[model samples]
Target: MPPTATPESSFSETAVFGDPVAQQLLPLTNGRFAIQTVHGFAIYDEADLMTVAQSIPVEPPGWPNSTLSASAEHLVWRDKNGRLFVQRLADEATLDEAILLEVPGNPNGWDHPSFHLSPQGNFGWLFDGEAYSDEPPVVTLYRLQDGAELVQFRGGLPQFTSDEAFFVRDTAEGLLIYDTTRLTEPLYTVPRDEEISIWDIDLTADWLQITKYLRAEKRPFVELRDVATGELLHTHVMADDETRVTPSPDGQSLAVTFKQDDGADSPTVVAAGVRLYTVSGELRHEFLAPQISPVPIPSACAGVWTSRRSDPVYSLVSVDFAPDGRSLNVTYNDYVATPVTHLYATDSGEKLAEFTGHESLFVANGRSFISLSTDGLVQQWDTATPDATPQTIARYGTPITDLALSNNGELAALVNETGAELRRTADGELIQQYAGATAVTFDPDDQTIVLGFVDGRIQWRSLADDSLLSEMSDYAAPIRRLAYWPNQPEPTVLALAENDCRVTRWQLATGRQLEPLHTILTFDEYGDVIQMSIDDFTLSPTGNLLAGRSWFMYGFGVWDLSNDSNILTELEDQPLGVRDLAFSADGRLLATGEAWPLGGWVGPERGGLRLWQIDEDNVSLRWSTELDQFVGAVAFSNNSSLLAVGYSSGDVTLVNTHLEQFVGRLETVSGVTGLAFAADGRLLAATTRDGLTHIWQTGSP
Candidate 1:
């Protein structure tokens, strides 16, 4: 039998729960059966355990940060928008009745809503439910009954003495509870407010648990306390935060899963590593799980849990943890918005090894290209004979944007909200700093750096001495994209405005503005021109052809540069509508990526990727291929024999032109922004959204 490609059998195990998961319950519920899987949420139904609900048709942008909560009445959760929702499994088509649970005028902002539902349908709790003391440890609590406001409180609630009362939230100072038998005050009070976050509480038994958290130390501790007598029953400190702590069916030992850090940008909390902790604060046994870390880095306190037997860490993007937590689920870097690294192991807290195989876009030598992932560092590849191992260049604190490479490829410039930094590619050292730069590029002469802003302004600086090259341009709108003609001798530049569909060409030396070329709109409603490249401004390749994407309509075509009209047939309504546009090295073909589509707005895998055999002779599509995944970027190696495709899922596939078969596959990277083939045709460089770059080489030429 052919080998089956099942999810990590052990670490990525699917636990059969009672009901189907409602993934739409963002932030509050972990979405259906399997919460937050790469493709979508794994939902389960009460009928058959193995059968799971598939992800929704639409894909969300960026890494998904979700929280899940399961209640008998409904499943709830939140998405990146911080919106709260409830999902009912009865009818799959009903998507209404979502409530915005964010409170009015909460200082903590709407992003952090302390929402928790009780399994007993008592009341829900929001905020701290205490009077605002205007201090570091002020606690306020809001009570909810049947999803409606029930009561609000300042300080601690009145203590309860009945067996039907149960605590919902706890702090060092006190505990909040649901009083089945109404009492004027059914809350218990502790002495202080600092040292604890109540993970669970049982008011009837006069028992509560304070989960201790230390961020810098990456450790999580728990203490069992007697609420009635303020007695510390037992204190247990674990190596890291416990991804899940579920009391055994008999309530003797707590099945605990410690969150281990996998070296990926964002690690998922996984099970495979399980421990049984006695309620008396005793360690019964810790199942030694396999190690999955690529390196021996300590855990950074990130983890999650599905059951007492299953614990996994969640990542920003997507990840796969192996069964035993020993072998790695081949790390797919930049596989999604933020990249996810997964470690396979049996123990939830086992150290797992991970490798990142993705690249980022950066600036070098006044040219912008994708960087290859060489080890953990970023490197740059020259288009000329680009086969060499991209020389190791700079290291960014996180990812970088608006990188400006000097003409000689010696110095680099980059920016983020914190400001901009210019560094040397050779030694990865900082050269200068600037404020508020959105776009960075090098001048054609490699003598200066250009800085574009969000406020419709552009600035330049001389590279030789880091002096101001020219006064900033006071354009009408933010410069969305900037490109310098590839082979131009003088310092000429193209500026894209965010406010309108206009491409402005400016000659730096003469300050001469040519009549805006290709300003006429092809579609009634203007389309977003994702990217624009210049080869020979004379339109020699395809007879006055200008290639780009149109707004609302994702289409790829060559337009008559003189008239701004479509030359070849246009492609429209594709999900990822022209994330990137590339002309084959021979200029006989054009490729467009289906990645970076305006997700959350549309769904229809419309050609995941398509290659048009440029009928330059007739100016039409000769032939094309239908891709399956969302293509983020595309490139044709110099010889045009191999087509490199980078996908939003971080999967990179190299396909042969003649047979259109897969030639090679690289590690999954985040959304690929740009692709550049080396001059030698043997290497490919891919740039990702995470601000890292990578170089890919193959054994076969």
Candidate 2:
């Protein structure tokens, strides 16, 4: 099937940073510039002032980059709130005035706004259109004015699914929405005839760009398009192992970065690099840095940091770019107790600052340190100097079982050796402590804390005074996990009990059981109940379903409680010794991790993930991939398109569900024990058996 052609803006050629070649130098406007870093957006004002736009927390399984674009009057970005944010980038502006326009019907995936900005300062968003049935592809157009939405135009584009995104452009006829999903269908009236799969699309002022790779090809090619109409855009075929692409703010240049590969699926064998091109599709310059060998820290390595203080002896792994595009800030490779690397001038590759002895720093309004010491302390540091001096903000000297941070950064709840503690973020002060607590979380209001204990009890405590408000009980064994449905008003708790492999729901403030306890205790060959997933379990975001594994059966099952006759459908052909399960936020997909013996041998050898899409009565097994070592956990991105698999071998792989292809892979700490996504969908936190947490920056989409 070929993608259909639509009338809208599109992008094709892209430039990327860290492309294993060398740092690139792009001429900036007024000698000041902006760069899209790994996580957030960065800008350097004309005065050489550097500022980070926003630090969105990564959502687990995984969340894609928030749709971001800048116009003459505002910079628009999607936050974890599942809403659109329009911030006035004009100097001296506050986010308070950054209007947040809610999407009608509360669309899922926090689907970023897809619109076009007119030179006259007018912008339009493609809203959820009216689906009257048997429609082709249609999207409603809503123009932005005075922080509100106005009906601009409608029914000029092809019909598309709500999950699909599109771009708009103004032409002689009117506004048009060009859908890229048509790429999966047959090309009828479309322009270009390349049969490549697209990873993403970007639109420039004069041209539309697409990042695509042909079937069985090593690297993706860049295709360009005309802005006012669906015209053939130029194409740039790339070499294998290409990594990143960036278009200049003025839409005149494209920077690309790629790494050389010795073999397939091998760690890139070169230094970070770059390439540049003009809007006319002409190669301008190529830069290559001296390749620095990766120094493997002791397998005792605890974590990686971008702003940490240590002896200047170890390598670090950090990527920060100067706003002027004249320099790049990089930390050495992540190593045991490494220090923060320095910012090097892109032109001369000269060091600007050497942050020694400081723990890794997370920069916000000001610099803050972050450390994972052996003593169970999670600390923050200043990035300016090597003063390894640390400030102990929070310490969990005991073994930790489970933890959760609220949607807002106001609370931290965790089950440690001393039990569950609800800590206030203001001063890292212990707000409340509960004994034998298995999991803790903050309610939607951020005023109440729900603590689930091993004794099959759940308590809701007021955050202000630590007073117990309500308690729900009636479980068979120790509760292993607790989760709440998103945006629900009442306090409904989903409890997972390991002893009997049960999933139960209880309503707070009312001693009522919302539903009967569901379990994986299905009858075996002899009609005897077999307990499964006594070790771990995961609940869908809506709390209407639960996914877990059976230890001996080596399979994962989904328990659906929305119907009269609740059913637990076990995924077919799952390997034995299944460990964990994760569902997308929408509960449309399920990802499972399992460990099994290879070559029909005895001990656990191979494992990976199996993904399933939920239909009405039957489930569609989408794809399955095998791994080298045991898979500890699996998570789906908020969009349900990508799955993050954490392996016991300290490796993480991101896979696209639709294409069933690998997106990227990275190394983590020791065997992963727990994996969580932050509310912002920007950072993924993985807790390993080594008692360390590794946070990875999911670069901008």
Candidate 3:
């Protein structure tokens, strides 16, 4: 059965970025820029030189941009999971995300594609740069000139050649060229008898170049097709056993290299030749291999890693004539760790100092170009001046996964591999930083912050003064959570292990362990008194009851927090699938959810919720409702009137506890990981594993 459709939420919306790190930056009109993070996008005005102001959050978290817009009033980006999204600049009020496409589970076929935004930003070219080995390649051509989609299709990226007449697509049928003016119909189609595999495809200003190996003929071939009509202009084939073909940037010359089998049974290049051709396939000039000193990675520019020496580690391979055909460039084609491109004089064999990167180069001009390195550093190179040293625009900050500029371009926010930071953009100076933090909790006064690191390091800091107060580092295990206590005189921290049942208390200012108590007393399958996992647990707002899931026992338990660390009651039924549970604000009603049962007679018929009425000695079940999918999250309203449940299938059901019936449903593509009710019972929020938080208002009308 199909899931229920979620209606439009009527509650007002405001996005929250919890220590978000910016990954990409795109400059827009009037000194405003879009700072993109793995979670969301923030538009900031750079009116002030030092202070960032009026920063507004737009789009949902987890909507990352593969490509960004500059002049057009829209944002174009693809999420890390290969979901495409486009949003108009004007409509910033609602959840109006236009989902462009979805890449399947295995996105190997849809990798490394470039987002081609038109000069005016009205149109966008959606594509995969390389062809897939299994399925037919597809692309979408979107015309968003008027902020509405004009035309889009499943094909290859649009071809905007100098002739501006045709674009090509590799459909299941075959390679077909279509008229740019009329996008729906193909003007010419390349005939094919059987299935064919293309190695590399290049569309230049005046021609279409396709490189493929024909198994029937036992040879590799490069075919040049005419742009006006998809007719084969020329076919270059290898006569020897092993050969490599490289087309020039202008699509005029084809460099052919013949290889011989060395003693190791590997192909060794012994002969090479460059064959020049005209637009009509006429042979222009042929140049053979010449002896010369090869260019290397400049001594001034150091490689990113230890393997990146001052000199070239590998030979200058894969030769291709430059656009002007005056010199030749030897570079690596595949995406390698340490990538470098060298320029050599093809005729004189003189070494040149120019070495570009593996991917696209940011060419400022014909002689000068800029490129973003594989290590996320910006590099500038000048081809005209051979002796000029390389200039690094932004020095790389290692261990930081992402970085972006603040609203006013005065500061930069970075998501560190371990934590997060705010740095000065001008000099790369560290301003404020956190160390190895996995989770953070603030005190009620908002003056103290307790941080839990993955390495089991717990520390306290003053949020008002940005000073470290105390820290502890001898937990023997990583800390999973840190909670701040408000009713204490000195700051107190409650830390829980990632998988254990003990909650350790520590003095925030002294860094001293106050006490260690086990929430659940249990023995393993061997009946030993050991640290059994409290698979799932939650405390009531009034601290009256502490409920937990007993994985090995195949049931859940309730602890009397007011008395001692003892299980006041236990319910033996369905095992805890996700350890999902919640209690009402008054502590009188408890809502517990169970996951799918393991290898047993039970199934999802038992995967549902059970309402419990808490008493002094024991708890009694009120009612239980079976759910469709395994439970992932559960929550209750502050007033104890409504119960919200989330499933592994991303389905959320709102139930009226008074009426014992489900009233509404919320559906999400990404499964829910967390759920909560606002303090005043005004907002209901749910968070996904992909970092998306959905919050809406719910109250009695």
Q: Tell me the whole-model lDDT of each prediction, alpha carbons only.
A: 0.45, 0.51, 0.55
Off by over 4 Å in 2: 1-400, 409-412, 421-433, 486-489, 521-535, 598-604, 697-701
Q: What is the lDDT of residue 253 in candidate 1?
A: 48
TM-score of 2: 0.41
Structural RMSD, model 3: 14.1
Q: Each candidate's TM vs. the true structure?
A: 0.41, 0.41, 0.44
Provide the lDDT at 94 for model 3. Answer: 51
Worst 10-residue stretch by lDDT in candidate 1? 9-18
453-510: candidate 1 lDDT, tens digit per residue? 7566776668778776665464644555666645455676666554344456677666
Best by lDDT: 3
lDDT of 3: 0.55
Q: How well is each residue in 452-511 modelled by candidate 2, as lDDT tens digits?
A: 776668888787788889888776345667777554556676666544434666777784
How well does candidate 2 score on lDDT at residue 31? Answer: 32
Q: Give candidate 1's error at residue 465 in angstroms.
A: 3.4
lDDT of 3 by residue, 369-438 (tens): 4444433444556667755876654433223322223223334344434465544434446677776555
Q: At residue 326, give the lDDT of candidate 1.
A: 24
